[model samples]
Target: MAKNKNGSGFSRRKFLKGVGVGTGALSAGLLSPAETLSHAGGALAFGTPQGPGAVPITLHINGQAHRLSVEPRVTLLDALRMDLEITGAKRVCDRGTCGACSMLLDGKVIYGCSMLAIDAQGHEITTVEGLSHNGRPHPLMTAFVAHDGQQCGFCTPGFIVASKAFLDRTPHPTREQVNHGLGGNLCRCGTYHGIREAVLDVGNPTGKAKTGGQAHGAL
Candidate 1:
């Protein structure tokens, strides 16, 4: 037992040597701060590390379930169009500002480009391809065609999906409301007039009147 100058049992040199030995043990992987802390806190097991490769994701699209292996960084738009072959959601501005990649996530409108594919799993995703059923077109689709709402058609699918979401929520919206609701989608053909008319047409459709066995369009 070494004695210090002040009569302490342990000398400063002994304390320094113990510190050096502890540091050497720590550097050599014999002692880990994390393990020591975890033991002190009564934690027994360390979590398993994530495996390599893409993660398994389950996407509910258009009422159908699709299992895919996608990277953590894959965008929802890419997953829908490229991997899943559901090209209804267009990729115009890869960024979220364009809204051309708009789709229904759990019945709510969201920009697919902005959302991660992994995050969209387990949510009901509706694309333009899933809008029509049993060969019958959706009301908005019919209205779009009837009113010539689409011109270039590059942005048609996105507009139709976005419009469907809006009209489903508000069947009879005013012009201001329609404009505000559809503010997310952009059309390069500048066919806003027809789009507005189409939305209104669906909201208020004139029925034929029967008089004396003759059919006449209702006023």
Candidate 2:
């Protein structure tokens, strides 16, 4: 029953206790939507129009259409590898730097890991596994094997996909052009010699060296 100097009934200890209760109530009112939903035993809706559960999406991959339920936040690479079971696109350096997750979207090379699956709708996605026809290897794939362009083989799929897209545009690229074109991709095995040889062989179809490309790996 301690009293203040002013002889008021409201003691400092009582004021402090009231302040703590008020702060707790204020904090409860300011809970995030997700926290509120969880406390109320409700689910949160994702994407626009706000509905529960994953969004339904359609993907056109390798001349085939597939329907899948995926979260809007899922990346195209994750959708391809986890949902579609297309494991050819490697998930290395997923920040779009290493190019190990490169794939063709609408016939243009794109970083699969950096693209959202929801954003890939209405476009043709081509992975390295799609380059073959009826179990027949692509010409670039054939050349890669012949020239021993891959070692450890993790980055080969992305390199092949990117190379195929480049070759499609520039049928006869110089070694410098090839080096610049494939600059985004990195091979830890130091297979630039073999990869340059493979592309040159495909472009020329005869053994003839044009330019010596600097041996450098993508970061």
Candidate 3:
């Protein structure tokens, strides 16, 4: 009975060893020839060759095509400022909360920092630098200057870009609408009143002109 017990134990150990070998061989065999080659190539490639960097992208900015090579992780703001030298979009906060990096994507307002350069491809992107035409400033830009809407001027570009978008959609927005629309931008110099007046001036330039003319006539 002891001999039988010893024999059973030996058989069990042998069976376990066999199972282990069989599993390893089965796993190796399960991988197809193409898969094995690919795995080997991947390892060797990583060891010997450097991976490709910075994919090529074509961006339609302000009615012009700009060809650029940029990394996948680069934001639209970085690509625009660093690569393309278009620095109108400020890099304040570097987060989507502040509208400092605001720009027009397909005629719609979007934060440049929040959007990936790859995603901006194949779309028309309008930056603050591009808002002007024929060396003339945009109406919103002109109004901002006329109304003294900016202070330190760091946040001016973003405000102007956002205002352009707002005016495009609602050309005749009320003072309350301008305030609400521009609430996303923060002014450190307490220039909210001027900004609001600038937006209002864009919508009601005739009124401003008439008032100015009457003031001059009275004087």
Candidate 4:
């Protein structure tokens, strides 16, 4: 028989008993938060507690550091759209599934809706709005427009951002490769074909060169 080995986890019997005790105490108003913390023992770490209120946090976004006071539960998408007024990332699914709220964190693609605003501090966040140089569009952006890669435009920003990450990883990709690379982002308008084409156009210079480098802007 195996014993509870540090953070490995609790045995089924121990877990059920603990849950039963805690739930009953919580329901009967007998378990105080301080008491609960006190019972947790020193080594069974729960990490540093945050808050049930707003906290000051700095988010480095698009070469700028935006300081704001937001609740610990506030998502990065909410911070960008609500607090910071940088609303390039759409709030469609609000979950990580649809990828409408995708943004580039530290030059890598991530779903903004799933990440806490507080956790994004000290990291470079690039939104769709940042993908322009002196108001000039990135080549991938141009190619997207030229290929009619967007229709509803809700998923376009996420697709473009994800495409930028994809191109960075696979700068010279085939049509099938682009299709596979950008599988994370989805479009309700069924514009996958055009989106793939745009990525290919940006990758292939044999066709008219759209703009600049793969790393240009957010692309």
Task: Give per-residue CA lDDT, model 4, range 28-126, as digits (tens).
Answer: 123345543443323322387766666556677999866566678889998787666677898998879888898999999999999998788768999
| Candidate 3 off by > 4 Å | 1-52, 208-219
lDDT of 2 by residue, 1-219 (tens): 235888877766447646764222212223455543442422233344521335556678999876665677779998887666677998998899988999999999999999988778878999998999999999999999999999998899999999998888877777777888999999998998899889877876754444445422222
TM-score of 3: 0.70
Q: Which stretches of candidate 2 lie over 4 Å from their true place?
A: 1-53, 209-219
RMSD of 4: 15.8
Cα displacement (angstroms), candidate 4, residue 196, comes to: 0.6
1 against 2, candidate with superior TM-score: 2
Instruction: Judge candidate 3 at residue 36 and give its lDDT.
Output: 43
* lDDT, candidate 4, at 87: 72
Sort by TM-score, top down from the best: 2, 4, 1, 3
Error of model 2, residue 185, in angstroms: 0.4
lDDT of 3 by residue, 36-150 (tens): 4443312211234321455455577888876665666779998786666577898998888778899999998889999888668768999998988899998888888888988
Clashes of each: 0, 0, 0, 0
Q: Give each model a TM-score.
A: 0.70, 0.73, 0.70, 0.72
Best by lDDT: 2
For model 1, residues 151-174, the per-residue Cα lDDT tens digits are: 988888888888889878876666
